[model samples]
Target: MRSMEVDMIRTLETDKAPKPLSAYAQGIEIPPGHRVVHVSGQVGVTLDGQIPADPARQHELAWENALAVLAAAGMDHTHIVDAHCYITERSHLGIYRATRDRFLKGHRPAATLLIVAGLADERLVVEVDLVAAAGAAGPAT
Candidate 1:
């Protein structure tokens, strides 16, 4: 198929689960053509740059940020094909899964969550990165 120029990539703050809880978007979309995105590691950094002290809170932040990155790239959880999650506390795995599911809403992509020794930032409790793809809708311009 012919590819078109993609434009208008924007991030969305999904549900009101938490604000600035993570550095991610609820969703994203690129216009005109197919899109490929590489979301970077997201941590618990609120809009004000404050890191949540609680690991659970930070984990949510990381996922949120990661989602934001995907939105900026014009993709959402539905478009995600691969993902890597880094966590400091393994016990919080359940919490992470639950919070992540809140956004997924059934769009389960290929993913890997890892329990790490620690993150680069001391305040960060978790980090995530992922890749996504979206087919260009409509005809090429």
Candidate 2:
């Protein structure tokens, strides 16, 4: 197996959405010799794998999951360079922004928000995909 080293990866969200499901940013900073982590779409679920019903709550869960993945790999929000968010309810954009602000604080990554028909899970109101880089300075713009 091949192993790699990383310096730092940060995760951030505005009041817009919850933290991402991975230790990736809504965007990333990368240095040379780095590997980018591509996280799959994550729904709002508890650590034990309990899914939430509320659209806003589900967003929170998805974000938390993303962060957990990043931390496990020695990364955080700051390392995220790109993000994809899927929302079932178009009106949830406001909630997303609020939550994002709460989580990201200031750092905003390059992101695309989509209003989808549905997600993998029905109760899941939102799902997020993230891109994180390790062994680099930061994400590439």
TM-score of each: 0.68, 0.72
Give the alpha-carbon lDDT of every model: 0.67, 0.70
lDDT of 1 by residue, 6-72 (tens): 2334444444544433333444444446556788777788879998787778767777888887776
Q: lDDT (0-100) at residue 134 of candidate 2?
A: 59
Native-vs-model 2 lDDT?
A: 0.70
lDDT of 2 at 116: 93
lDDT (10s digit) by residue, model 2, range 1-141? 121223643333365656554333443345567778888887788978888667788888888788777776677776666777889898998887777666665646667888999988677888888886656544332
Clash pairs (backbone) in predicted model 1: 21-61, 22-61, 22-65, 23-64, 23-65, 24-64, 24-65, 24-68, 25-67, 25-68
TM-score, prediction 1: 0.68
**In candidate 1, which residue ranges exceed 4 Å CA deviation?**
1-34, 138-141
Cα deviation of 135 in candidate 1 (Å)? 0.9
